[model samples]
Target: MVSQLDNPNLNLIPKPSHTVKGLIHIFTTAHRNFFTDVMAQALRIAGQGTPVLVVQFLKGGIRQGYKNPTQLSQKLDWIRCDLPRCIDTPHLDDSETASLRDLWEYTQKVVTEDRYSLVVLDELSLAINFGLIPEIEVLEFLAKRPPHIDVIFTGSETPKSILDMADQITEIRRSHTP
Candidate 1:
């Protein structure tokens, strides 16, 4: 799907292929359907046998409204920063967050080792915003990532540097009813 950002002159569209290289996707939206968006897009590509690594920086399980996609594909890997919990009890903690270095390490390993073709950095912007991670280091990783890897970023308050590096950018706005 192709969408326009606030900049009318620019359009954001995700086009991927095994041969595609150095692609970046930034998904910025207040709408709650982004998981579906992420899942649909990632699954299709991963289903094609391209490895996809998903990292969720949020401090909780999948949001209530989002359907967490299964790791049905052998090529898909999901690494979450939140602690696991049963549905009946939500483990609330202030210190469960993954450190900036840890996230950076995972990203670096994926990129430097060429373990994945697509990477989804979910809520990474929030981490950067809260100073949970160093923005410069993340930017450096993105800049140095192998040309064959494609990256997708999802969250509110995306950093401008990220937006500047994006090969495509999409923004979804919430609808209100009176």
Candidate 2:
């Protein structure tokens, strides 16, 4: 056999470059009102200097709205629907519907523009289930989001499509009655 140190084809293969991509995390429970852990995690991440956005989809009563996002920290933003009461059902007045649509559109815009390193969609499942937001649109948004941005979905009755896309799923359950 001849000396094999003269192969030129090996150099044609391109080397893989290192790229960091974030993941989808889903937190679900059988009942509502249990996202303290997710909130804490968002706060911790924001405290570390990574930009974070928290959007409460079905929650209201404070009139926070998309234009009036509350800055929790230097790198954290919190927003809610601009309604006089929290949404627990599918029925919505014209103004309420408009508010939800505005928030949803704003969220998609910011995420697509790569504004945050992490995003928390609080009560997203309820909004989707109640027909306030379209699931297909959400899927498209997730697929097109910046590669380095992590997303967290927290709510009860999370749809199968969203759960299927999650890299991590945490289901919360109570051990005792309150």
Candidate 3:
């Protein structure tokens, strides 16, 4: 059952639960500023005291740049954090060297240890597409995400499985005929 909402030729479907357990967003272009703004608004809707996990999917060089960490902190300043280095490198290349179980284990560690309000995976699709990260691990990460945490995945390309399971699917695209 696909539904549409008011937006730029995209679906702004309402979330089924105010306490959303997981979200997978597909952006067909590079729109970081817009994505971040919308995400902040969505997080605000989460139930009081509920933690949000955002998995941001950045494209191209953001991963190599290692800048999403600091920028995210500034972008979501309403939330507080100790400000650990963003985009921990171990998880970057390990997607190639490590198995899905290992990636799941690492994600479990971060989510549990940080007790994060949101988990953002930036440029996830790109990482998997480029073989920098394993697809199975990505799925496992999605599967194992806790109910208390809100998980978000953003990128230009998303896997069919992820899209199939999405409670809310948001797509950002340009108006070719506009």
> How well does model 2 score by local distance difference test?
0.92
lDDT of 1 by residue, 22-125 (tens): 68889888754677789678889888998988777663454311124346588887766434531222232454443334545766876789888888888888
Q: Global lDDT of each model?
A: 0.71, 0.92, 0.51
lDDT (Cα, tens digit) per residue for candidate 2, span 43-101? 99999999999999988999899899999899999999999999999999999999999
Instruction: List model 3 lDDT by residue over 89-121, tens digit each.
Output: 335443433432343355457676646656655
Ranking by lDDT: 2, 1, 3
- Lowest lDDT 10-mer window, candidate 2? 13-22
In order of appearance, the predictions have TM-scores of 0.72, 0.88, 0.52
- The candidate scoring highest on lDDT is 2
Q: Higher-lDDT candidate among 2 and 3?
A: 2
- Regions of candidate 3 where Cα sits further than 4 Å from its true position: 1-33, 38-108, 112-114, 176-178
Best of the two (2, 3) by TM-score: 2
* Higher-ranked by TM-score: 1 or 2: 2
How do the candidates rank by TM-score, highest first?
2, 1, 3
Q: What is the alpha-carbon lDDT of model 1 when measured against the actual structure?
A: 0.71
